[model samples]
Target: MFEIGDKIVYPMHGAGTIKAIEEKELAGQTQEYYVINMKIGDMQVMIPASKIVSSCIRPITDIRALKQLIHNFHHGESDEVLPWKQRYKVNSEKIKTGEIQDCAEVVRDLLRMNKEKTLNSSEKKMLDHAYKFLNSELESIKGITDNQIKSFS
Candidate 1:
């Protein structure tokens, strides 16, 4: 269970702060929902505790875990080039699943490609989204600004 002011990762939505906990009557029963305010935008979402796991609401990764992710992002790369359509399809799936590790994989793959040449609009947007998601979590855990994190990268 998350309390107000706690940071959580909402699949596809990235990192959000728990703004409030509220109870509402629905279907003749009272249920509680966590009100999450997105860090990157003016969006607020309500998630029921009963469905938290399925919704992929989870605590941010700890420092060690985050370091592992960074290491993987830095080291994991494929020399074989894949067709753009296939790469887009696979990366889209990873982004949709809202798994942090999967997002890291997408960032790593795109960064590798970028080193070789420019990316298409869609690929650039995906890379930006992944960077936003990871950077938010990194900022929260490291007590630094996203810009600072970007500077080091």
Candidate 2:
């Protein structure tokens, strides 16, 4: 049960703040909904309160753990060399987890792959989306930025 102003990450959609909890009638049912204002896109999303658990919403990560993950990610390798199809599946799964650490790896791996060879259209789109998610989460974590961005550089 997140209160108003609680920061949360919606899988594949990045981090957002709970702006309001409103009740609306839909299909003759007055159910509570969470109104989330997304950080990066300046967008708002409304999710049903009852479905929050299955929706994979999670609280924003702590600065300390985020820093540790950034450090480890910077030193980690990204040369598994899987075929494109398999790689896409793996990355998709990570993004679906809504975990900042996993999102960081997807960003790092895709960036590495991009450097070695130009990514195909689909992978390019995926990288762009993944980067947005990664950056949005990074922005959500107060007083942290450059290290994570620097890792891909």
Candidate 3:
């Protein structure tokens, strides 16, 4: 039941604002869809209204929660004990969860690993995407600044 103008994050897709909701006919049926204006690529995604719940599209986290996330990030330990293949598998699953905390953990662990040793192409690309995805959602939060977002690393 998100309304137009609501800010939401779609798993793996980053954050966006709900631009419109429209109904269109196809195959003699009219299905409603939410038109989202994505921040990262300046693109639009039309999600079926009925599928919103199952799609994992969710509202952006509040500023207080983001501050708490940053606090945990600073205090939490990186979990890169798993071998590269396993580590990649775990990180991929975390990104798929679409939870801000999980995404932040992936970014933190990957950034630390990248500093210690060059990550393989796969991990490198995942870091870039997850970083952007996390940042986009953070940016959607009101009264947040670029400096605060950079502290995640």
Q: Which whole-number lDDT from 0 to 100 does residue 91 have in model 2?
A: 90
lDDT tens digits by residue: candidate 1, 40-78: 676899888788888878887666676567667677665
* Whole-structure CA lDDT of model 2: 0.86
Please state the error at residue 24 of candidate 1 in Å.
Answer: 1.8
Candidates, ranked, TM-score? 3, 2, 1
Query: Which candidate comes out best when scored by lDDT?
Result: 3
The list of candidate 1 runs beyond 4 A from truth reads 26-29, 142-148
- Work out the TM-score per prediction: 0.84, 0.91, 0.96
Candidates' RMSD to native: 2.5, 1.7, 1.0
lDDT of 3 by residue, 50-96 (tens): 99999999999998897789987777899948999999999999999
Clash count (model 1, backbone only):
0
lDDT of 2 by residue, 1-153 (tens): 899998899998999999999999999999999999998689999999999999999998877786588775778887489999999999999989999888888888988788889999989998889888977877787767686555644
Write the candidate numbers in order of decreasing lDDT.
3, 2, 1
Better of 1 and 2 by lDDT: 2
Q: Model 1: C-alpha RMSD to truth?
A: 2.5
The per-candidate count of clashes, in order, stands at: 0, 0, 0
The local distance difference test score of each candidate is 0.78, 0.86, 0.91
Which is better, 2 or 3, measured by TM-score? 3
How well does model 1 score by local distance difference test?
0.78
